[model samples]
Target: MDGIHINENLMRRIVRSIDKAIADDIPQYLREHYKETNNAIIQLRGDYINENLRNLVVGGDIEFVPFKRYVWQGRIIVDRAEKITYTITTQKTLRAVPRKQRDKPHFLQTLLYIENGGYEAPVKQMTLMDLFPFEAEALENDYNSIVEGLIDPAEGYRHYVIAYDAEGSELRDVQLEFLDKDFNIIETASLNEYIKPDFARLTDVEPVDEDFNDETDGEAKGLVTIKSGLRPKLRDVQKQA
Candidate 1:
């Protein structure tokens, strides 16, 4: 099949929209949706997945300069400054294909990551079991979590999530740190929770999705009550319920 053309500009727009939409819920959404494919727990979040790939390649990072172009094995490749040549392909590539089935946004991010001088992150082999109930063997077998890290000797890839409250004034980026036997903020997600209860810890007492009440049909659900701030009007004197 002839490869599909992915316009760099259009792809950028779509990625921007995706990152904005997902800046809140995408991490969880990706984990739940793409867990089965490619041995990935959080398939959408790849070390090679560049939400900002276009910029990294073109805009300011002139450090990565393309030196030459060559055609080999039915694909035109771009050779960069460091004596490395990259094949120029589109959605036809294996990494691009599986990701397309998972999520378009994540697919694009992965491609961008690959094109910008990084090894492709093994997102295709991840699963939910690896995320919620990950074991040492499962992690070792899969190529995603640690093996794909930018820096080797990068052991202990723990996703320590910390939550914060946004009190309608300003956004305080409380940098999250993770711990060894001690503590530290390893992986961080920039979340904007501008409402009540900004976040609940995965360890926090799990709230029921639906409030549980043992009472009768009409005796009010979970702590139903009249609003205290409901101000009565002068017209209330004219009539009564």
Candidate 2:
């Protein structure tokens, strides 16, 4: 066995322990308690999973915040005056999750609201492509629609492109422009960025050999050569003087 295997085994044990702890503690709470609710249970499970996994993987002064749903509001401006309000709901803006594991700007759903007598009323509720017929034409013409055909069913959400910070740790406030087939900006919207903490530190783990065999004797065993099988070779070692 190697260090990776050992670490994975340790993680599995820890996860099992945490699961056992949750199971044991759940009975102490009544069914009417909020902890017994489906959302609460899911949140608790996610919290435990992230906390333990981060402790095992990142180590030392690191924290993990699980992903949560958020609604981002922006406005699409047409002709520099005609503006429409849009709202997107997604589970991408993780508070303290790692950049690699964080969700992309996936849209769970989108609502386009048109101003009616100074009050916004939802006019359409769908993807950008479905909401605008011109987007479909643009797609057929090989024009990138900013957000088209990026839906992930497995993700159970919608997707839109959003700017990230330099560190890629958090979303950045920026305007996403909707372009026509001619690559001209037809509309622009200001996207609200979700701020995330910068305390996460990723670390590398060095591998070490793990003994798998239990049988042993007092005398040191000589090298036992094997044929017709693979053997481990030492690489990248400095030659001794």
Candidate 3:
């Protein structure tokens, strides 16, 4: 892999587009569907952003690719020149940003480690390997043979989590995290804090439970659930490097 490279100017443009979606699209959607449950609201918000991000008008050679294959499918923003693919995910946060992964790992989540962090030696793999080895093996076997044709094959991947408050009224934070081969978060950035340096870190936030699971959403702690033969198992089309 060529390694992850961040283009600050392009990142700013992408972040601004997401901000607009949160500020404009979300409120409009909420107004239309006011009686939805909290979990339903989460899905609604995610679907709205996922759909609108494709229509985002961030100029230059950057492109957004939508993968409609698996259950973990979503759109990935790509900077052709930089050869970096940005994976977007949404989460509800007690703090300003998402600090933990799901109780059960998703295939795309696993691919993020392989891309940003490299599928190197065992001692270098992400901490998830030790936490959920059985599920990891299942996910690894389910990886498909398909590949997304790109102008330039991606060298690395970046994760962008759009975290919202529990009430779903506001976007608590938007974070860009860089990971190393050891699965440790090496750096973090947020456009909100970038534009305004004193953007309230929310240190008074409640302590987070690392084993967070939503009974309402029916996400239980077990083997990684995969919708295997239903779709051509695509581990990550963007990780061509």
Which candidate number maximizes TM-score? 3
Model 3 C-alpha lDDT versus the unseen true structure:
0.41
For model 2, name the residue pairs that clash. 107-158, 107-159
**Tens digits of per-residue lDDT for model 3, 1-241:** 3333446655444554454444445655556656535334434444555555544422355566655444534556655545555655543221211234555444345444445444333233335445544354544433322124442224444443333221233344566655443444555556454321112211112222323221111011111111111111111322332
TM-score of each: 0.20, 0.21, 0.55
Clashes of each: 17, 2, 0
Candidate 3: misplaced stretches above 4 Å?
1-5, 36-39, 57-60, 68-72, 91-105, 119-128, 134-167, 193-241
Q: 181-211, model 2: which lDDT tens digit per residue? A: 2222334344332121122111122321233
lDDT tens string, model 1, 1-241? 1112222322232233223222323433454465344333222222222322323222211112122112201211111112221222111232232223331122112222323212222223453322343333443333233223332223312211122221112223322212111111122333223211222111122222222222110000111111111123312532452
**lDDT at 154 for candidate 3?**
45
Question: How do these models rank on TM-score, best leading?
Answer: 3, 2, 1
Which residue window of length 10 is worst by lDDT in model 1? 215-224
Better by lDDT, candidate 3 or 2? 3
- Tell me the deviation in Å of residue 135 in model 1: 2.5
Question: What is the overall TM-score of model 1 with all chains considered together?
Answer: 0.20
